[model samples]
Target chain A: MTLPIETPAVLVDLDIARRNVLAFQAYADRHGIRVRPHIKTHKLPQMAELQLDAGAIGITCQKVTEAEAMVDGGARIKDVLITYNLLGEQKLARLARLNERVTVSVVADNATVVDGLAAFFADAGKPLTVLVECNTGADRCGVGIPSEAARLARRIAEAPGLRFGGLMTYPPADGAARVQAFMSDAKRLIEAEGLEVPCITSGGTPGMMQAAEAPIASEHRPGTYIYNDRSLVARGVASWEDCALTVLATVVSVPSENRAIIDAGSKVLTSDLLGLTGYGHVLGRDDIRIDQLSEEHGRLVSDGQIGLQVGELVRIVPNHACVVTNMVDAVHVIEGGAPKGTWPVVARGRVL
Target chain B: MTLPIETPAVLVDLDIARRNVLAFQAYADRHGIRVRPHIKTHKLPQMAELQLDAGAIGITCQKVTEAEAMVDGGARIKDVLITYNLLGEQKLARLARLNERVTVSVVADNATVVDGLAAFFADAGKPLTVLVECNTGADRCGVGIPSEAARLARRIAEAPGLRFGGLMTYPPADGAARVQAFMSDAKRLIEAEGLEVPCITSGGTPGMMQAAEAPIASEHRPGTYIYNDRSLVARGVASWEDCALTVLATVVSVPSENRAIIDAGSKVLTSDLLGLTGYGHVLGRDDIRIDQLSEEHGRLVSDGQIGLQVGELVRIVPNHACVVTNMVDAVHVIEGGAPKGTWPVVARGRVL
Candidate 1:
């Protein structure tokens, strides 16, 4: 049978995505926290608009170009908080241009990033908003301690054309208490200096259910929440039905009784295992394991008869939704198993 | 200091790439084997043109869309081989379209794929070239045994508008003996049936240097040889200087004395470990390891002082080159340590 969609296509179920958006938004609402859905997962302006319409305060982006893509895609996104350190003149110039279109805020863990932003926005009529990113044990990018966070907050407040926004942390999984302690200490320190801490943002989909534990956070930026993936499902945060995006692939070759190959490989599904065993969860086939992947071929193996023929279609929930979304240019939007049109992943390839 | 290129930019050294192409071409020439460089690594029609100009027989693409991109980019590419099973109406129609522009050939390991190709090209004036993909031991794709290869060869020979081209295998590393055994047996069987084996192609970058071990192979299709990555360096196939591609990143944060974060992450470097320990090798900083990666941040950790300050630029040879090439939209071409123009990754996102 000819499938409705082509092989190696990213299928986003609009109904499921809308449900996911509302579920997370409702969760954040009960906790008295604002939802600023990160656009890194879907990268589609329509999806961001759907989140904004679902009562999200604004949006969160990881890079300056992401915010530009969101605004350029014509989404009604007015407030964008870039949760990354903006370094160098080229990116800051782009960020300055984007700020002209929307209210753009950024995060900085050090004074160098603060100074770079200050230099770029120094001559602007409206000063740029800057937040201090606290490490909080993530050890990825952020200030090591609360004192350093306060120091950067002070630097932002003292710098020209920059306003001290708040504190932000891409917290460790299940470490909401640590995030709370770090942000609270930083807030007290900043407040001791007579500067108001406007917003404390912390997020991770694995621990979003317990977001209230980090009571200091005024807002949560969750990217994969709108398109639940295998990682969240494996962490018991979401069920299989909650996954809004899946990779549709066709079985091209069955080399052995226990082995079959699909067209979606690392290039489509990506190699972001996120600690998962296989490349993805083959829907309706629990016994098969996506064992290995080349650039364009995913090896599916089973102990017995693989039970897949050539031209057969299978849907896969990738381990990480954000990386998979970045792999494709566009995705097929589906509603109740019927095909809708395609949505360009506008914010994709905006890593600059 | 301001860097010449932007942070999180992929830098391709044109000189090193040209040297790699010529070196590999020379190796294959000495073995009396044809070189059909796979464009899956760079995905640039310009790089393909360089390889073709440097004594390569043709270019090999993994998908129909990749071939279309190469031709669309106006790369003077004539002969093309798509090393994938063409299935479904959409892909077959695309393959037919791509065939109109160039000499496009494909591989099939099963009767279903062969039938699909036959159905698509049956109405065309010229027949499609079909190679029976053999399963030497990669276990990814291809027919399992010599008898199956011979059986598929006969099927292709009998099908209208289809000609049995030869046998093809994406072989395992250091398994050239098994590949030779498998192909020689299949070639003998097909020849016994009064069919001539035209071009037996086998390839893998790890085993490319040993291409002569598979005496039956008339051509070698090596993708990563053009831009050796950390994986090849780890396998002792290519040195660090031989690596033509590097991710140019800036140190965004130094959260701890022994840890630093770069602007490049999975969005730029990708998560293709290729069985390596870390995400990538930090150039000129062997003591540091790119231990972790988020979507837009790469964490560099060291046992001692990391010695990287915020705003510092560092080049990184990623674990896998092909996936890294697919991550970004364009790569800045560097020549003799100077900046040149950027080349769009033409075949990127053409996973279909």
Candidate 2:
């Protein structure tokens, strides 16, 4: 049966998505690195199950709410590592409660977070596993140097309710040497203090395949490999055919010879260029450029050679797959250009 | 009562918001022009009710779902003008049904939209009011010139299910003269065809005050005036104090002396620069700049003078408020720095 879908719906190619899962899992296995797929890309429980079924060690989440949703969605999750500092009394309580149900671990780069976390689980049956987030070269989160990461890890090992899990970092793209140097030094410093470094995690889809080059990283957590986006394509991580997700939109206006407006806008396609030019890539329309986006209108510019009439359905591979994942509540899962089922973006807007 | 809130939550200062509503209504009131606050900014029925209570003639929406949500939110909406092409079988039927309950009008820039709209409302009790969307200067949508507007208006007037309802345009910022000339010519053309030109509407918050200077405009639709953002402040249209909405985030990682990471990323604060320099204006900190943002991290760069510690809460006025509104599921309404209530962003992600 065909479903009458509205315009501007998120579409997922199930065959490609599953193939992506198997391919990445096989590559990691061949390279002798554990695969811990991040749930922030698709957020669907079924997708998480597919990754787990394909032999991912566990799942990685940036927020506690996402982990909770995956658990509620019946993923049979055995391990969850949130790569964000769990802050505030309210969030700490939620984290503790979530820990009660599963083997949950988190990362922290500061003493305050460690102290706040220690206050809650100081005498629990199973202490919370904590990792020192190292910056490496991403320059966004984590400690700047190996010494800082070692200092934070020592602080965590001394805390009563926490056990030092290991080290984690989302390194800059194509910076495998920096990841190796950062993790190896941090491990050396922590091991020098007679503390065991059980694991070292490095992640980023752009450099995920090169992660095995860094002997320090026992596991890698890459999110966007499941549904490669335009930015990934620009970075040579994935080709257009490897992109599993696309926004299905209908052309609503042909105002001029060179301009057409689609129903998809910043609300669905999003404005995250991620250093790429234009908003997205149109399949089979290399001549068209989605140059501008209004709140509800995507302004398409062409060279007047392509006659895209009004009401024509066009599929767009967005610049960033993660942002588009959070834009829609549910997506149409298709296999071989046929409808299969719809999956809810289970953890959308779980920023808290 | 003080409610414990989470970080990266969308907060609306009720006092500032109501004051903004009154300020814009007063401007349109003084100029003897109708006010129609666009509901796309806040997407809350309570906000629409406030705009209507503050003397707005009606509310403008970009989609039928927004209108339906406002009506369901108990805004007591009597009239809704959807400033988009109403397309598709399902959507047009819903638009016709919406017109049955209230005075529903829409804008069409081409014959396809007009023909589709006419097919749905050809035998209704009241014909759907159709406005010719003209391109004054913001050439995203609408007819190319006054002649094109006149042509579409004539087609709508001849159609049995549609009524020619004057002209509308999202005019170029600070181009009130362009609006006057374009709209006057279109009105003259429609008048020569022996049809009444009841209204000519111009929209945009950047130069909404100057919209009254356009002699042809009988109404103005402004959405962002209710919650001014950093872009408006940069445009010299509103002050930082005038911004009502802010993303409340906590410092998650203080990686280095000059860099800090916040919990609000593109998921909450968004990546819409709107030709502005930074992501947002950090409240009470002129020295810090939000240089970059990831999906779950906002990279704040400073000059080592500002000391932002971990777990420190910060309020940020985002670059664009409307896009941020579509990011969250709900917002906290605050009165005198205390939480009064929580209102869901009811029309968020309603791209259809």
Candidate 3:
């Protein structure tokens, strides 16, 4: 059945998604770099298949649960790289089991994590690929310098049942140059020790467009490009039309001349303000700013005093698409304002 | 199987939840009012049952999808009041269909919405109970002032195939004084017009705590009290341990002496900064602040320069519990640092 443009439904523009995949893939191909588009943004196997069809080498997932959901949902990619550092006994065992299903690789910045991974893989009788994560000044994860990265890579190579796959880094915002320099220095230092530096993966959506020009990196993993959001548009990476996903909302109450409340709130659009003042961007109405969001209500205030009648439908492009994807059960694909199909957010809440 | 106290797992303290339910129920009972604790906070049928067991008249849900999930999951309460205004043909039909299985009441502030509800109930040969939502100053989903509320209430009462239950208001932050005055004035106006008002629902966690002392509202529908969050703690309605839910996250990387990255970022703890500066309250360390959050990494900085080692577990009480609840798949119940059974966030992401 065709669902109405309800107040809190997630809308996906499939055409835009397809174009984004092709565009990113073309940029990677031109720079002789493999594009491993991260599935954490859309988390849909159909989108993954489209990326593969457009010449993506593999896919990147943030969690083991997400990777398992993607693989089970018929993503035919042979290689899946988990960009996050895996720790703990349970997570390591899950990682080893995932390695049996696909060519799985994970990142590590410490010897303890490497040791835990080595111990798990050795007992599981499986070979696990490890990448030394170098901190490119994001200050979130990874080792401090290229020397620390090389040392960690050496440890992974020496550890039983673990193979050093190379270096991975999620750079600071718009830090393409820093990533290039760090990866180059780290690759040289690793090879100086006569170690095989096979792959250098640098990723982040903000840097994805500029990643192709970075000659040191062999692969790029960009998650947000597939479903560009308000933050991406503000960053000048993509336009509103380039946004593949939007929250379809309706004006439930137009109590005043300048104020209206929408059914879509933080529960649907998410609380990822992304430095944007409003909860979500109202399509075609730049005059209106979503002033506040309660649990189930989005309060819109218009400085220009636009009159919105109750029951009027509106579209909101969220500030962050990945977080919004995790806030819903199913996302509706729209073509010419009509429903195409619904895709379940299978990895909606796989935060583990 | 035992789940570890990992970083970024939703931890529910059952004892606190039970106490919160009984406290709210007692407030309502003492005031000669009906308590309909909104289940959108916990999203667990077990907790809803606790509220009902503690003398709650029924339960309130923000969406029809939540009501459906609650009713199907063994909530035998006869009346399920959907506190949000219903819009669109699809949702009205769903509302009508819900009346077939359970008692469903909706809120509306517009004539068009009342007509839509009337049409659906007329076709179903049943009367749909509706509360005229009033804007007591929240400026969210309600009619403005007493005159508009009475007018809307009158319209709903006179509408064919619709029964006007009474008035509903989601109050602003100030508290019971404003809501009491508005409700009393609106009730007087509506009753003077020869209309019987059966239900008068007032909303807000902090406001509900003072509801028993006030004489305005006949029913209270506080959603967040079921899983008190950082906002409630800040409002002085709940203490730290009174917070029933928290995101148990692990420190994934200690990038610097002052900064550590957690596995739970905007995706898990959510970007619901609320009025607070940080995303959440760090359980053990008030000195440390979650300075920023990317999609998958929470960057925590400490003023005391204390470092979080890798693999260390920490609990974060999110600024808003309802938003965090929607972000996870299951909540791990914990008592005295020991693991309990996992309960699915059953009605989570039911944003229809």
Candidate 4:
């Protein structure tokens, strides 16, 4: 049952992954809401299909390329929501092509994105759906206030070949209250303008379970919940066992009594510590600290109490599973501790 | 003519890159020593060939796949030294195949690696050359002391189908004194054992100029010298103008008066800070601080003086050029500020 794969390879416990898919669907089903798992987590069409089988509304992507990957990679999902500001001639054309494929919608915080998108889709037969991105608390992309969202929504509704698809917000972790307050005001303003607010999508894995706390949102988008990471575990949103993705690395070099090097470095495990102290958590070894990572080598400093032999396989729980997933070209999927097959990370490096 | 490459793409200044290669080669030639540029920095066959054109003796790779990449990707290198301890039957067979393609040598610090390699190459007609790696000051890999290296060298010499190829050490930056002392002792021990000591390779870009001061070394391997980064700039090993690699990202969202979001996030620019405070240095915008990064978003908080607008292209000098090169599949090569062609990062993600 041992995986006959190379070192520094990613392994996904598919049973656990399926369980994660079902568990999130159960959570959403309990709250009488729809679950739309973000495809950015695994970036594989297979995972997206599994989420769809578990009753997800659609797949969520952060960029046009990501959405294109899900559709073309054989996810077979009919609905897609791109949760980023799409701009430029190149991306807008890609967005139009994507919208032609499925019921596609995108979020925009500024008028520039809206104008660019409108210019391309203005001649389309079916109107494009555009969501007004509201800044609940992430402070990255989105409108600052409810009025801004209302104004953007009106602009989308008035633009040719575009429809107002309601509001969307990517709030910070533990900011469900702020989302509730902001989304409620934006929704009220949009409804007062005699426009139908079809969907309000709010997202964040840390605040996933409490997404229903913002009762105004119709659907939720949580990317990392399908894989879960050190950040999610630290926030008590998920336990270590709930994590389906793990990097199976080998002890390549033991430099000293206190230091050992693994084949998984920044290229594999990644430097996204997610505000955690160490690079990753080594399963079954609490004393080993993954203190540093070079491009192709991860240096682990041990407590010197337990000796690790060279060539021993160690499973590592990375700080952020989403970023780790993007680092690799494929993952070796397993079921019941037996190697099943390799799953292509089909959408990896599709940052365009 | 400007490059038609999309935003958030990697750009390589070929003129500066060629200058870096020639300058390092000239230094090695002046010292009457051989220069082997580590392909781990650029990872492209074109780049490796460029180094060869600049008068490098050979190439250095951290993994067998990289060697395979250089040889198969048309670098046409005759000699390659893999500075990693090759393990497992799969990698060994691959290494043998690589050796059949070109002259291949590897490094080993412990008897386990030596024994494993010996077992794999025991029946081969041509003996595989292996170097005893010594840890002078950098506590990452290699044997601890001169005796350990000497013992390993003796083991390599006695093993069937293997040759003791002197010593190699990836010393700490500015540790010429330590490398000299340890290599001197190791060389004396190996020579006393009646084995021909062929090479003594020391490596580190930060200590490139001072490596010649360690008279015990025969050759030097410095990868980052070709594409210097913010780390080399901070350490005074390279100037700002010497940096040849940059990530061209567009300001996607200006969240506030002092905040901007760029398309180059951890996925493109990476999260390898290398002890630097910020992620990267934006060219001509010291007022902008690339304070944080998400998967597809780089959050920049400014001093509110120089305003950054959406769609404006900003070139960023990353913290570590080596890791940045690994993140992209291809880089846009430029000459004299005009668009050249794109160079495929052929060896990228070859962590195995």
User: Candidate 2 DockQ score?
Assistant: 0.85
Per-residue alpha-carbon lDDT of candidate 3 for residues A1-352, written as tens digits (9 for 90 to 100): 2354555788898888888888888888888989888898988888888898899888999888888888888648678999888888777767778899899999998887888888888766678999988888877789988899988999999988999998998886678888888888988999999998999998888878788667888988888999899999998888998999988888888878899888888888877777777777888998988889877888899876757888777888898898888877888997665788989988777776
User: Model 3 chain A — which ten-residue stretch has the worst lDDT?
Assistant: A1-10
Winner by TM-score between candidate 4 and candidate 3: 4
Q: Candidate 4 has what TM-score?
A: 0.98
Q: Identify the runs in model 3 with alpha carbons over 4 angstroms from their true place.
A: A1-7, A335-338, B1-7, B335-338
Q: What is the DockQ of each candidate?
A: 0.88, 0.85, 0.69, 0.77
DockQ, candidate no. 3: 0.69
Error of 4 at B49 (Å): 0.8
Candidate 3 yields a Cα-based lDDT of 0.83
User: For model 2, which pairs clash?
Assistant: none
Candidate 1 lDDT by residue in tens digits, A1-352: 2346678999999999999999989888898999998999999889999999999989999888888889888558899999988888788888888888888899988888888899889998788999988888777888888888888899999988999999998887888999988888889999999999999998877888888998999998888999999999999889999999999999998888899999999988888888889899998999999989988999999988999998888999999999999999899998867888898898998987
- Structural similarity to truth (TM-score) of each candidate: 0.98, 0.98, 0.96, 0.98
Over the stretch B296-333, how does candidate 1's per-residue lDDT look in tens digits?
98999999999889989989999998989999889999
Clashes of 1: 0
Candidate 2 local lDDT, A76-140, one digit each (tens): 78789999998888888888888989889999988888999999889776799999998887778
